[model samples]
Target: MVAGRRSGGRRADRGWTDDAARAGFLGVRATILPALLALGAAPVPADLLIRGAMVVTGSAAPFTGDVAVRGERIVAVGPRLSMRATRTVDAEGLVLAPGFIDPHTHVEDQLLGTDARARLLERFLMQGVTTAFIGNDGGGEADVRAVLASAAARPVGINYASYTGFGTIRRAVLGDADRAPTPAELAAMKALAARAMCDGALGLSSGLYYAPQRFAKTAEVAAVAAEAGRRGGFYDTHLRDESSYSIGLDSAVEEALAIGRASGAAVHIAHIKALGADVEGRAPNVIARIEAARAKGQRVTADQYPWDASGTSLVVALVPGWAQADGRAAMLARLSEARVKAEMQANLRRRGGAEKLLVTSGPIDVKGRTLAQIAAARRLDPVEAAIAVITREDPAVASFNQSERDIRAFMARPWVMTGSDASTGHPRAFGSFARKYAVYVRERRVLDLAGFVTRSSTLAADTFGLKDRGRIAPGAFADLVLFDPRSYAARATYAEPERTAAGVRMVLVNGRVAVEESRLTGVAAGRALRRMPREGTCPA
Candidate 1:
C-alpha cells in the first residue's frame, strides 16, 4: 500500500462518501497517515497539497489519491498526504491531472510585441495548460535567455519553452533571399544555433516551406541539426510541405525523416496533418511510415492542433509561391502593378478561384469578413478584391480549410500529442484544449477521457523529454491541473476569440498556485527549463 502519516492537524477532509468510505476510507487512511508524516519530514514541508481526487499520473490509469508539493517538486503521492502546506487545494469530485502541454505554437515573437503575452497567458491558463512550446514552424530569434528574462520580469501565468527557428535565422542572415548559404555563412548559422541551445533552447526547428528556409539545401539544414544533436538537443520541423503545394506531402515527410537520419537528432513533425479534402485519411499511411522509421531506431514524434482549418497569412492563399517571394513590401509593389495583378489573377484561377479564402487579421473592415463578400461589394473579381483587401488592410488573413475526417484520424494515433497552433487573437488560442474535451470527447465521443488526457498531457511530456513533469507522480514536478470533466468546455469562438474557457477549477506550476476557482492568482512561478546533462556527463 502507499505510505503516509498523521500530522498534528485534523488533516484535509477525507472526501470519501458514506458508500465509498466502506470501500476505501479506512484502508486509505491506514496507508495514508504515516506516509504523509514521513513525506512532510523528509527535508521539506510541501508548499502545496491536493488531496481526495482522481489523479491521472501519466504512468497508469486514473486513481483516487493525494499529492504533496515541495518547492517545485512533487514530494509525495499517496491516498491522502498529511504534509503541512502554505496552501491546500480541495479537489473533491475533480480530476487531478498533469497540466496540459501545447507542443506546437507561434507565441514566441508574437509575445515580444503588442499586449499578446499577458493575453495569451490568460487564455492558456483558462484552458488548464501549465506549459507551452513556442517557435513552431521555426520563426523565433536567438537571444533565448534575454527573451525569456524579459518575459519573466512580466507576470506570465504559465511555463514556456522554445525551439530556435531556422527560418528566422535564414531571414536574419539571408533577408528573404532564395539562395543557399555559403560555407562561412553556414558555419555562422550553426554557431548561432549552438548558442541558442546553450541558452536553453529545447532544440532546432525548421520551416522549409516558408521563405528563406525554403531556399536552404538539405545539407545546409543537416549541418545545423547535427550541431543540435551533438549538444543533446532535438529537431522539430514544419516540413517542406503539408498541402499539395510546392513539395508533395510524401516528399515532405521523407525530407524530414532524411534529416533526422542524417543528423542523429530526435525529430518531431510539427502539427502533422493533411490539408484539403483531396488528401483525407492519408494520415494512416504517414503514421505507418513514421512507425517504420521508428523501427529502424529513429526517434520521431508529432503534434496536431484539434481543428480542420489552419490560421495563416492570406498572401499564401491568393498568390503563387514565386510571385510572393519578396515578403510584404515586394508583394505590395506587385499589387501596385497592373501587369503583376493580371498574372496573379491567372494564378488564383488555377487554384479553382479565391472564393474560399477568408479575411481574419489586419484591417478592421476585413478582419472577420470573407473574400467573396469583399469582391461582391467592390464590384471587382475575387482576385482584385483579394489584392485590394490585402493591400489596404492586412496582408495576412487566416483561413479555415481542413477536413473533419483528417482531424479525427490524426488524433487517434497513440503518438499524436495536443497543440493549439494559436496566438492571442485566434479562437484556438483560448479554447483549444477545452474544446478538444467538450467537443471531441464529451459531445462527439470520438475519444474517451483517458485517451484525450494522454494526447494532451502525458504524451506531450514524454515526446519532449520533460523530466519530472507531465504527470502526478511522487518526486515529479508539481505542475498539475484540476477540473470538472463533465462541466468543462470552451466558450470562445471566431467572433469572440479572446474569451476564456469554462470549468477549469485550478492550475499549479512548480508547486505554486497559478489559478484558483477559475480565476488567475497573479502568480509567476515558472522557470526556464534548461537541457539536462546526459548520463555520465559532468554537472553544469
Candidate 2:
C-alpha cells in the first residue's frame, strides 16, 4: 500500500501486488500486534486516524489498511479500523510509511550559531525526516547534554538522537592531533564515553579517518565502544578510511568490525561508500566484507546517502593527515610553510585532484565552483587552491564529491540504510532524503516507491533499534509525513544548499503537527530516543 498527502477523501480500488499484501500482513504482525493488547474488545479513542489510502507499514506483510494513532503510538491498523479520533488524515493516492530516520548528521552545530531552532525545523521537516542522529564524523556536538538541553527547550520539527563521538573524546583528552593515545589518555577517553552515555548519548561514534580520531588506536576505540555496549547503545562510525588516503576501504571496515567485536556493541558504518572512478564498484567488496562479519553473528550494519559524490573540506583532499592535524589554526600555520605547502599539493592530486572536490559553501563567488576552477582563477595548481580555500575559509566550508552510480549501488544493498553524513558542511544536510526519492526513485526508477520508502524509513529505524517508529501501526508514535509522490523533490544543491525539499506537505513528531501543508508550524515536538535495555540483542 502507498499513501500520499491529502485531506477529507475516500478512494478505493487501490491495486496492490500480492507481494505488497503479504508485506502488509507481516507489517501488521510486527507493528500492530502490541496495539491489539490495548484495544482488545474496546473501541480505541485515538488522537488521529488516517483513512481511505494505501498504508505502507514498514513490515514484510503485504496489505492495505487504515492506521490509528493514539497519543504517540499507533493503536490500530487494519483494512477497517473502527475507532474514533479527534483528527483524521485522508491519505488517498499516497504512501503512509514510517517516518525516515537519518543516521548521521551535523545539524547540531546550528545551535552554536544562535539561529538554530528555526533553521533545524525548516530544514528537516520538509524532507519528512522524523529523527536525525547528530555527532557525525567527529565534527560537532561538543557538549552532548548541553545540545540535548537546547534541543529539548527550543524544539524542532524532527526527533534527534546522538552518538558520543570517539573523536570528540580523543580531542578532549589528547587535543586535536594525529597521534596515538597513551595508556592514561585512553583511560580518560573511556571515562568521557561513560559520562556521555550517562548524559543520554545513544552510543559511541568514531571517525578514524579524521584528525584526532585518526590518532586513536583500534584498542582505544574498542574501549569506548565497550562503554556504549555496557549502556546498551550501538556503535556508529565513520570508518577509519573509506578512501585511498591511508587505510584502504576494506581495512577501514576491518577496524570498525574489530571495535564492534571486541566491545560487544552493534557496529554501524556511517555513510558507507567508495568514492572516485578508480574505486568504482568497490561497493561490492565493502558490502561483502561487512556481510562476512555478519555471517559470524557480529552486529554490523551500514548507512549511505543516495548520492555518489561525498562532500567535505577541500583540504581533506589536499593535505596529508600529518599536516592536517592540530585543527584549523594548525592547518593555516602549515600552509605558510614552503615544505608543507609543496607536500600538500602533491597529496591532493594523488588522492583525486582538485576538480573532484566541488565547493558547496565558502567565499560567495566560490561556493559552487570546484577546487580546479578555484585554482585556475588563482593561477595555481589544484593543490594550492585547496590550501587557499582552507586558509581562507578554514575547514568550515563545504565540498561536494561523490559518485552517483556508487551511491545507488550502495543504497540498493539490503543491509545498507540511509544517512546524510552531511551535517553543517554539506548540502545533504537539507537534501539527502528528498533527493533519494526525487532522483533515484522517481527519475531514475532505480527502485520502486515502496522500495525507496522502505530503505529510507523502515530500514533505517530498524537498524537503529527504534522500536516505536518506522511504521504507521497503531500504538506507534504519530511520527508521520504526507506528500505527493509525483511532486516530491529536493530543492537544495551545493550552490543553494540550505533550501528545503519541494513536495513534503505535512509532518508530525510525537503526534503533533510540526509541519502542515509544506510549512513549519513552529512546533518542536521531537524527542530524544535513548538506548533501551534489551536481552539477546546486546553482545556479551
Candidate 3:
C-alpha cells in the first residue's frame, strides 16, 4: 500500500492540468481573454482553494496568503495564486496551518477488527490531526506487513505509519520468558526488526518499563534496535521508568540515551516527563541530559501529551513487572498468594497511593472512581480491589502523578513534539492538538502560534521520516488545517472522553475535504506513508 496504488489517488473530474485540452483554447483565447477579462470571469484552477488566510508556513510567522491544492499536493502558496477551481474556501479570518500529526498513538484497534473506521478517526479529524503514528508503547502487532496490509484494505480518513515494536517481536521469538534471549533468539528478533523496516515500518519502538521488555537487559535491546538504525530509523521508547519505580526517571532517560548510542539510532523518548511524587521536579535534569546529547551531534527528541495525568493500564501502573512476566494468568496466580499480595500492597503504597490512581474505563459502574474510593466501596484494601478489577477486563487509569511544573518545563523544550499517548478514558485522545493552540498559544501564550504549529506538524513529520507531510508548500501533500484561535477548544475531559474538539473549521487530507465547515464529510482521504530515508535529518 505504501508503494503501489492507493485509495485516495483518484482526482476529481476537473482536468485543469490537461495541456491538450488547453491547447484548443489558442484561437479561442484571443476572443475569450478579452470577453472574460471584460466579464472578470477568470477561472481558478484548483480542486480546493483556501484564500485570505493567515498562513503559518511551518516554523515561520503567520502571513496573509492563499494556498492552492490541485489533486493531492499543494500547487501554490503565496499572496495570491491563479487557478481554475471548482471549490474555494473563504478563510478570510482563519489560520491556515499544516494538519497536526500525532507522533504517538494507539489506533490499531480502530484500523483493525472494526467496521467503524470512519467513526474512530473522526475524533482525530475533528481535532485537526491528519496523521497518527501507531505502534506506540511497543504494542503494535509484530508483523508490520500484515498489519499495514489489513489497515490499507480498510483505509481510514487519517494517514498512519507504524513501528516494529520490540515487545511484540520479543514475545513472538521468546514467548514472554524473562531471561535474556539466546544468540539464535537474538538473531531472530533482529531479523524481524529488519523485515518490518523493509516492509515499510518507520522504526523500532519499545516500552522498556513494561513486562517482558523489563526482562531484557540494555545489550539485548541494542541488538534488536540496531536493525532500525541500519535503515536510518529511530529508537522510539517509553522509557524504562517514568517514576522512582526501579531505575528512577533520570536514569531511565540515560538508558534511552544509551540505547540510541548503543544501536546507532536516533533516540526518541515517548511522553517525556518526571512522573510521581518522588520525582516531581526532575524535568530539568532530563532536559539538560538531552541537550548535552544533542550538543554532541546525537539526535535525541521526544513527544509529550499536554495533560497532567498520564494514562496506562492498572496492571502496568500497579503490578510489578516480575509478577506479570508470563501473562494475566501468571499475575493473578501471584496475587492469590499471601506473601505476593503483601509485597504488592507495599509497593503500591510506596509509589504514591491508591488515591492517585483514577480508573477511566471498564466496569461502567466504577468508571470515574479512584482506586482508594473503589477500595472503600468494596470494604477491601485498594491493592486487593485493583487486583480484582484487572482480572475482569484490564481497564485503563489516568494516574494523576505528573507535575504541572515539570510538564511546563518539558513543553518549553524545542525538541519535544505533541503526542497524545491517548488511550481509553484519557481526554488527550480526543483533544491534545487543539489544546496546544487554544490553551497553550492563544490564552496562555506559552509560545507563539508559529512555534506551536511547527511542533505539532512539521517537526514530527521530518523527525519520523514521513515525506511531503506536515507543511504547506509547493509539492507537499495538501494536508491542511483551517481554524480560528478564538473559536477552537479541546472539549474533552476525564469524565467525558468521547467528546470531539471544537473550532477546527476545515481539514484537507490529500487534497480531499475531510472536515468541511466544522463537520465531517466521512471521506477516507488518507494514505499509509512509508519511511523515507531522505527526510530523516534533524534540522540545524
Candidate 4:
C-alpha cells in the first residue's frame, strides 16, 4: 500500500508519474506548484499535511505537531490541526524543520548546461538542503544576470542564489596582473559589483587567496565591497590567507573584519579555519578577534564545512600565485625553473607535509593516495611528485591541515553557521550537513539538535537575507526537510565521496516534494531566490 494518504480536492488521475503525483505520492504537490505559494495568495484548498513529526521552530524546543502547507507557504503549523488536506504524510518518527540552507557552495558544475545533470541537484536534497548559495570563492560566473537567468530557464531541485565574484570582475577588468588597480579599473570592478547586487546578488564574494583577487589589495576590496554594501548586500569572502604561509590566520580574520568595518557591509567569512601545521591550535585567537569585531558593531559571521581536510587544486594549495600570475603556461614555465620550483617546494612543505595532502581525483593511478605515499611509489620527493601530477592532470587534493579542536571551537560559536563549499572531488559536497548531524549533534553532543537545526537553517537564511526561510512558521516558505532523527547520518567519505546520506525521509522545495523515501522524485520544484533589491528580501 502507498505509505501516504490522499484526501484533497485537487486529486489527479492515477499513476505517480506526472508532476503532481511524482512530486509526492500523497497527491498535493501538483495543485500547489503553480496555483499556490505565490507572494500573496494562500490557495482555496490545502495542498499538503505532515502529521506527527517533531517540529523544530528555530525559536524553541521541538514540539509534536501538524504542518499544513498551502501553495508554497506554511499556512498553518500547530499541534493537531483539525483541517482538511489533500495528502497526509504520517511522519510519526521523523523530525521536520525548515529546509537546510547552504550559504556557501560551488554548484556551478550542476548549473552549466541543459543536461539532466544540471537539473538534478539530488545530492543537496538528500542532505536536507532546499536552498543553496553558489558562486563561491570567486569561481562563479562573472555575468551574474546570465547565470541566474540560465538556472531559471532550466530548473533544478533546489532554490539558488549567487554572489558577484571580485576575482571574476577583476580578471575581466584587468587581466591577471600583479599590481594595484587604477582608479578606472577600481571603478569598473565596483560597477560590476553594484550592478550584480542590484540585479539580485546576495553580496560580493571574493577569494583574495586566489589569483587576480590576490592581486587586489585590502583597500581595493573595501572600495568594491562598499558598493555592494550601498545596495545593502553583504561581503562574503575567502580571506587572503588562512595560514602562516603569508598573512597568517589571525590577520586573515582581522582582514575579513576590516572589510566589514570599512565597507559597512555584513562580512561572511567562507570556510573559516586555522589552516596549516603552523596554525594548528589557534582557533581561540581567531574567535577572540571575531568577538572583538562583533562587539564594535560590525555584522560579521562565518560558515564552516565539518571536516579536517579542505579541497582545492595543487596549484592553489601549494604553488605561489606569482608563478601562476599570467596563465597555465606561465605556471608550467615557472615549474620548469629550478630556483622557482625550489622556492614553491619549500613553501609547500611549510604549508603542510606531503602526508597531509591526499589526491582526491586526477590521474587514475594516483587518485586515492597521499602525496607522501605517491611520491614514494613514483621514486621522487613529494614536491617533485606534486609538480609532476599538476603538469600532467592538475588533480585536486584534500589538504588536511585543520585541528579537530579548532573545528569544535568554531562550531561552538553562535556566529558560525554551515556551508559545504561543496565542489567536485570533495565529500563535503555530499555530506557536510549530514556529517554535522551525525558527528557533532549526535556523537559528540557539541551541538544539540535544536542548535544544529538553527545553525544549519535559520542562521544561514537570516545572514543571507532570505526572507521567512529557516523557520517552521505560518507564512514562511514551505522549504522543509523531514528525516528519522535516529538514522540521519552522512555516508560520504573522502574515499567514497559520491555517496549520499541516509535517513532523509522527504524534502520539499516550495511545497513540492523533491525527495521522498530516499529517492529523487525527478521534480524540478526549485525557483531562483533573488535578493529583491528594493525589498532586501528574496521571494520564493
Candidate 5:
C-alpha cells in the first residue's frame, strides 16, 4: 500500500493500486529474487524504504524505483521491492538523487563555532548537500587529526572531508613573507604536509592567489605537494591568476598542470574562471589547455560556481601581493603611500571599477553599499574610500567581473564540476547548489538533470577518492537528497546572503534523516570522513 503524504498535500494511499502493484513486481521480482536465491541469500526487511520516486543514479539514467536502506548503507535499489520495511516514504513526483558534494566551502567557523544552530550547518543541508569538503584555498588547519577530532566531538548535520592547506603550512614554517623557504624551512614544510596526509587529509590544497603561497615558486609548491602525492593524494589549488593579475590565466593553468607533473599527483583547480575585463572570454582557451593535458594522460579536473561575481576580500582584490607581505599592519602601512595607492587604483579599475564591487560585510553602515557609493558619500577617490574601509576592517566584496559566455563555456565541459567557494556574506555560501539546479539546469538549459547530478555528486566523489558516497547503488552510503524539481531554487542573494535555498524535501546522511519537508530535523548525523593513510605512511 502507498504510505505517507504526497507533494501536493494529498494522502499517499488515496488511489487503491492492486493492479499497479502487480505490474511493478512482475519483472522486478522475476529478475531479483532468483539472483538472491542463487547466492544463498534472502531479502530482509529494510530500516527505511522510499518507494515510487524517480531515482537519478549518478552513473545511470533516471528511473522510477524504490531505494532501501539498512543501518548506514543502501541495501537495495530496484523497481519494486517486496521486502517489508520498518518505515516508508511516499516519494511520488519527487526527484531522488545522490546528495551533492560541494568541493569548496568555508564553513569552518560555523562547523567549529560555539553556537549550536551554526554547528548544525542547516544552510548546506537545505541546499541538498549531504557531504562537503572543507579546508579549501590554503586555509585549512595544519593539524588534520585535531581538526577532525574536534569536529567529531560535536554533532554535525552533514559528512565532511578536508585537505591539508599549503598556506597554513607556509605560515607555520615561514611566516607571511614574500620569499622562498630556506632549505630547512622547505624540509619542515614537507614534513608537515606528510604528517597531515598520514593523519587523514585528502591532499595538499594551495591558494596561489593569496599571500605566502603566492610568493612560492612553482618548484617550491611541487616540492611540498610531492609529500601528499607520494602518499596517494591529489593536489587541489586556487591558481595564482584567474585573470591577468600576475601570470595570466593561461599561464596559471599551465603552472597547475606542471605542478601535477612534477609532483606525480592529479591536479584539481578550484573555482576555475576567467575573471576581470582583461580575460573575460578566455574560458575556451582554459578548457583547451586542460583538455590537452588530459589527452596527454595527465589527470586534470576543475570546479566552477554558477555566479558571475566572485566573492573575495577587498585586500586580495585590489592590493598587490608584494605590498601584502608580512601581515595586516605592514600592508596597511603600505596602503597609505602614494605609489601603492596609485597601484591599488589601477587594480580597482582592472577589476571593473568601484561600481562593480559591492561590500557585503563590514561595519553596520557599509554592508550593502557599493564601493562607488561609499566613495561618493565619503567625498574621496574610490581608492581612498576603499583604503578607509580597509583601514578599519578588511570587508568581503562580491566582485562582478565574469561574463555569462565564460561561465557557460566552462560549465558545459565534462571535466568541470560544481563548487560554491562558499564563504560568509556571499550568496553562494547558502545557495550555490540550489541556484545551479534552478538557473542553469531548469531555466538556462546549460545542463540536463542527469548531467547536473553527475557533476555535482559523482565527479567530485571519484576525483577526491570518496568511495561509496556519491552514487545510488547497493552497498553505498545512504547519503541522498529528495527534492521537488518544480520548486527547487536558490533564495539567497547578494543583499540577503543568509537566506537558505528552497525545495530540499529531505536529506539523509549515512542513513539518518537530517532534513525532512525542507526543514532541519535536528539530527546531526554527520561523520568526519578520513582517507586511509597509504600503507606504511603512518607509524604503527
Candidate 6:
C-alpha cells in the first residue's frame, strides 16, 4: 500500500506549523496576510477547511482529521487543525479521501462535445471520480495535441489525461487492410506514435481485440509502441484475445508481455478480465504470469471494473476479426455467406448464447432486450437476428461472460487498480467506484476502505506519474471526495444504466467545490492533464 507518512513526529502529534502552512500557501498567503497584518488582524489560514472527517489519505490508514485547502493545493492535513479558514465544513461522520481516479474511460466525446451539461460529467462527480483517462482501448486519436487543445478550450468538470491509440494509427496508415504494414508504412506509424508522445499523450494504447488493431502482428505493435516507450511513455492495451478467440487469453497475455519486452515500455492491461466460460477461472494463472514478469523486473500492472458483465458492441462480441477487415459495409456483405454464418453461430454459442447478450444501445428500439428475445420476436435464428440487427445498426451489448470468482481474484491483486472502461450504455460508466465500495469493500470484504482508496487513486497516480495527486497531504492537488459510508452505493444497474450513484456528499477539484450535499455546484475546475515530454523527446 502507498501509505502517506508524516515525518518529525508521531501521527497524533504531526500537525503542520503555521509558518510551514503559510509558506506552502504561496500567493494566497502573500495576498491576504499583509493586508490582514496592516489591520492588526490574523488572516484566515485556509480558503476551505473540512473538520472531523475520517481521512483516507490514499497512503495512510483512515484517521479522524482535518484537511485545509488554499488555491488549488492542500496546505494542511492532520487531526484537529486549529487554524481558522474562510469557510469550514462540518464533516463529522463522513469519510474523506482523494477523489477516485478512473484510469480507463471513453468519455472523450462527452468531454469535448458541444453539449454543455454533458461536459459537467455529473455522473462521475456523483460517483466521486475527479480524474479520468481517455482515448483508451486503442481508440484514441493520433493527434494528441489537437484533442488536448480542444479539451482545454472547453472547460470540463473532471480532470483527464489521454493515450495515443494504435488502432487509429494503423487505420490511418493501412486503411483496415488486415495485412502487415510495409516497411515505409511501419515507419510512418512509428513516427505518429513518437509524435503523439512528444505532443503530450500519456502513452500508446491498443485494443488488439478490435478490428484493424487485431490485424497488426505482435512485432508490428512492438515497433510502434517502442516509439512511445523510448520517449518515456507506457504501453496500455486491451489484449487481442480475452477468451478462446484467435490466440486465446494466455497467449494474448504473453503477447502483451512480449510487446513490453520488445518495446521497453511498462505494460498496463486495460479492464483485465477472464472473459467467457473458456477463460473463467484462469485469473490465478494470469496473475501468476504477470507476477512472474514483475519478479523479473518487468513493470506490469492492470485495472479492472468490479462487474461480472463486460461491455462491447454486438459485432465486436460475436463477429470474427478476420471478417471485419476493410470496414463495416464489407463485413455486412459477407454475413450472407454460408461459411461466415456458420462461424457466427459458433461464436454466439461460445459466448453463452443470445440470452447472455443484452442489447444496450443502437439505432434500433431494442434497448434492454436480449438477442434471444429479439430472435424469438422476429421468428428468426439468433445468428440470423444478430445479422439482421447488424444490417440495420450495430448495437452495444452487455456480455454476461465473466465469473465473480475471477473478478475477486483479479481485484485481490495489489497491482490491479480500479477502472470503469466507461462508455455509452454501460452501468460501469456511472457506478464502478461506488459499486466497488458497496459490493466489494463494504459487503464482500474483498478489500477494506484503505485498499479501495489506494487502488482507486494512489496506484494510478504513481503508475502514470501524475504529480501531487492520489494522496491527501501538504502540496497535493485538492481533489477530494467526502461521502457517507453508510449510504454510498451504486444506484445504476444493467437495466437502468444511466442512474447516478448515491452518498457522495461533496467533491473538490483543484480546491473548488464541484459537488456539495450530493448536488453539482456547477464548478468546472478540471484541468487537462498532460505528461511533460521527456527532456529530449521534443524539439528545443
The model with the greatest TM-score is: 6
Candidate closer to the true structure by lDDT (higher is better), 1 or 3: 3
Tens digits of lDDT, candidate 3, 1-540: 001111122121110121012233332332233244235466436677788899987845678888777667666676765556678788998999988999898877886656755433988999899988889877766677776666456767887778889999999999888999989999999988888876667789999998888888999999899887867777999999888778888889889899899888989999998888788899999999999999999999999988888898888887777888888788887878777677667667645789888899887766899989999999988888988898787788888878878988898888999998877789999999888778788887887888898889978876765555777766566789999878888999888887999998999987788998899987887766656332333221
lDDT of 1 by residue, 455-537 (tens): 88877776666755677665555788899988888888876777889989988887678888989887766654555323232
Query: After best superposition, candidate 1 residue 352: deviation in angstroms?
Result: 7.7
* Pairs of residues at least 3 apart in sequence or in different chains that clash in candidate 4: 7-86, 8-86, 36-71, 37-71, 37-72
Clashes of 2: 39
TM-score of each: 0.86, 0.86, 0.89, 0.90, 0.92, 0.93
User: Model 3's lDDT to the true fold?
Assistant: 0.79
lDDT of each: 0.71, 0.69, 0.79, 0.80, 0.85, 0.86
Question: What does candidate 5's lDDT look like per residue over 439-463, in tens digits?
Answer: 9999999999999998999888777
lDDT tens digits by residue: candidate 4, 1-540: 011111111111110111121233223443343234333354455689999899887766888887888777676676776657899899997999999989999887785567765567878999999988888887656676777776556877888888888888888888898889889988888888878876677778999999878888889999998977766777899989888767877888888888888887889999999888788899999889988888987888899999999998888887887787888888888887787678777667766788888899987889999998999999998888888898887888899888899999999999899889998889999999999999999999999989999899978866666655788876666899999889999899999998999989999998888898999999888866666453432222
Top candidate by lDDT: 6
Worst 10 residues of 4 by lDDT: 9-18
Predicted structure 5: clash tally: 0
Cα displacement (angstroms), candidate 4, residue 57, comes to: 1.4
| Native-to-model Cα distance after best TM-score fit, residue 204 in candidate 5, in Å | 0.6
User: Candidate 2: global Cα-lDDT?
Assistant: 0.69
The alpha-carbon deviation from the true structure for residue 159 of candidate 5, after best TM-score superposition, in angstroms, is: 0.8
lDDT of candidate 2 at residue 258, scale 0 to 100 = 88
Candidate numbers, best TM-score first, in rank order: 6, 5, 4, 3, 1, 2
TM-score (C-alpha) between model 6 and the true structure: 0.93
Error of 3 at 286 (Å): 0.2
- The RMSD of every model to the true structure, in order and in angstroms, is 8.2, 7.6, 7.4, 7.5, 8.3, 5.5
